[model samples]
Target: MKRLPPLPALHTFLVTAQCCNFTRAAEQLHITQGAVSRQIAGLEDHLGYELFIRLARGLELTAEGREWLPKIQQVFDLIGDSVEQIGAKRETLQLKAPSCVMRWLLPRLMQWQRERPDAPVKLTASLQHGVDFQREQFDAAVIYGTAPHDLPAALHMFDEQLTPVCSPMLLKGAPGLNAPADLQQHLLLHPTHDDQDWALWLKAADLRLSNIGSGQHFETLDQAMSMASHGTGVAIGDWSLIGDDLNAGRLVTPFDLKVKTGLGYYVVAPDRPEPSAKLRELMVWLVEQAHTR
Candidate 1:
């Protein structure tokens, strides 16, 4: 390894320069601003170059700092990743998650971060219908379904059923939505899929409407949820996702009707002789955290 400066100061310098604010970096590092300032000053003395240009407003990286920032930051992140890998713990785990589960998992992931601070988590979403895990370069993926998935590396996680959700404002504004037939008057969000999820829900509810026409189409559940939150239309979202929204009062399910999706969340990975350690740890964590409903 190349000779390196003291880690604490190096970390302080990198974080501060990235934020362009000593105080903000200190807050993020959970250290005193004075300590952050001292570290940067020490790093400058060791390197014999000022890394920042201090202004009355805040700070800006010097030319030298700008050149060095990316390299040093990548090194710092790699160090963290290395520790986990060497320990047989985990380094970075790239995950392909359904947009719905992403919202639910992200908030709860803070607890996991606290436990394994060194683990790098790379989360991305999939909108491609019936994803090909290997082709996508994901270590593991969480998708909605229980069918005979073609990938042998996949493991079943959780089954989530569907529910109707709309902004509370919509429900409160229009009392006529108490019956399923009243959906004719409201906009409904639709996703492009081989399976029409909302249509199945309507059938389960035994309601007939003149219009099965799509009101607004979204490529991802997250976008659909956002639109519904803005009171644009009703969203037939899975509770595993929209549950938090429903609980937080952003949305409400005025009707009790819900349906079992033929699809649920599945955890998958690339088939190989041996998978990376980080991927394995993440797969276990994902299975343990699977939501039941």
Candidate 2:
């Protein structure tokens, strides 16, 4: 902290130096000229140097001021860069999608961080997260919905399919679950996710249930998946989201049935211009990293 100046005073001094007139600088800064003068004076006293010489016409940069201008500009430039970096570090990578997508994306970010190291990835759970991407200061968005539809300049990163997931303990205990009717004996964990996921999975297997799904409903896929992980119940999980857990032996699908949803993960940027290198790197890495899943 000792290496830094009083921010307000430094701001005043910079503006005054730019205009070379306290009055104009005050107007630009919406402060009184006297305040500007006092700030510059305080800065000079702190440095044991005079930065300006007053004249009836206006103000002139002293020899010291002339020497300091470039250094001061460099300091201000450094400050600006530091602030941008901080903003980027904590920025919200708003995602307009289901909570399950958030769960999936965040865990995999470690791969990207291993490369960029400084990239900050934030996630939001909403279907409309990308609508105000610019105004909300979002660097990029990962949307979950049917694709081959119109998207922003961003790329379609990955395609997702559905697979059944259940707690290992539950599946072992429930037994007879090789077919859909046996599911009636157990709780069906659902968050009212994508339409027909359960129905399609059953349809593919030529099975139906009068009450195949009768259990407490969750509000988010993350919640449902968590319960499934704990052997609480069975759920229809998007492969893209639960694929890692399945591979890691944390969860498993006892059945081989699979079906594709109309939905997939899309990495959308604005329609206007090329996304910044940072956003581009983030977007590309996300797609490439998850495509195999």
Candidate 3:
């Protein structure tokens, strides 16, 4: 390792050089004038050079001291930059959720941010099918499944309830929906995923849909729900994911029956000795949101 003067001595040298007066430098540094003088003397001795000239009125920097000022100032600037970058990284948070749940959770998350003001959550809209949480740097994630693996802890947020929903306008127009069997008269939207939500609901109601495969198919439940809300067709949706639309009158469950799907939403977090304070607060808030829903 390279030998260098003590850090405190370097600080004192920089302060004394800037003021060119020991008494003023000590006052600025919140130290006794004698202590400032000692530190400067020690630094000069370590460097094997005379750094100042004692004058009748005050003091003046020598040739070497003037040349060293800029270099020392650069060092302080670098240190300050490094500290700020580290602080910013610590404050940031990363989170992941499926696209469908993201739409429903985002508004509630905004409310949480407004209430807390200090804790912020960064959301990543992702599907769980191909994700590897263990390889990623997410602070937490929301997953839909019966059980999630490779997590320190998984908190079940809510179970999915599948119900047939469509725009009120659809009910007012041609082939209006009145019962599960009446669904054959109108278009049926299907999600690309093989959740078989429609088939499950049909089985619960003791009914069958032979043309279920013919209707327009969407990549996500969000897309199918969007089509349903526009009166295009009927789509099976989880009540948890469409609560806002239900309350806002954009979509309505025509039937009273709700089929309980085995899958559920869970908050998955890494295992550790103790959870972060922010993460703990978020988990609690998520549970509350699910309960109220």
Most TM-score-accurate candidate = 3
**What tens digits encode model 3's per-residue C-alpha lDDT throughout 175-245?**
86887899988888875556377888889999987777777766667667766887989998888778888
* Local accuracy of candidate 2 as per-residue lDDT tens digits, 1-293: 33344455677777788889999998998756765776687578667889999999999999988887777788899977975776575643434444447667766775665676566555555635344555765556777666634545657766667777887777667455666567776677774634366777778778776655456455456656766776767787777678777887878887776788666778777765667777787877777867766
Candidate 1 lDDT score at position 20: 95
Candidate 2 colliding pairs? 97-126
Model 1 RMSD in Å is 13.7
CA lDDT scores, all candidates in order: 0.71, 0.69, 0.79
* Model 3, global lDDT: 0.79
Q: Which stretches of candidate 1 lie over 4 Å from their true place?
A: 1-90, 129-136, 148-150, 193-195, 276-278
- Candidate 2, residue 131: Cα displacement in angstroms equals 3.1
Candidate 3 lowest-lDDT run of ten: 125-134
Candidate 2 lDDT (Cα, whole model)? 0.69
What TM-score would each prediction reach against the true structure? 0.61, 0.62, 0.67
Worst 10 residues of 1 by lDDT: 125-134
Instruction: Flag the better candidate by lDDT, 1 or 3.
Output: 3
What digit string (tens of lDDT, one per residue) describes model 1 on residues 1-293? 53356555677778887799989998998756765776687578768889999999999899999998998889988987975666465456667776567666675565676777677676676544346754677667776666545777776666667777888788778645777777888888764432377888888988766656646665556656766776878777877666567777877886887787767777777677466776677777767776432
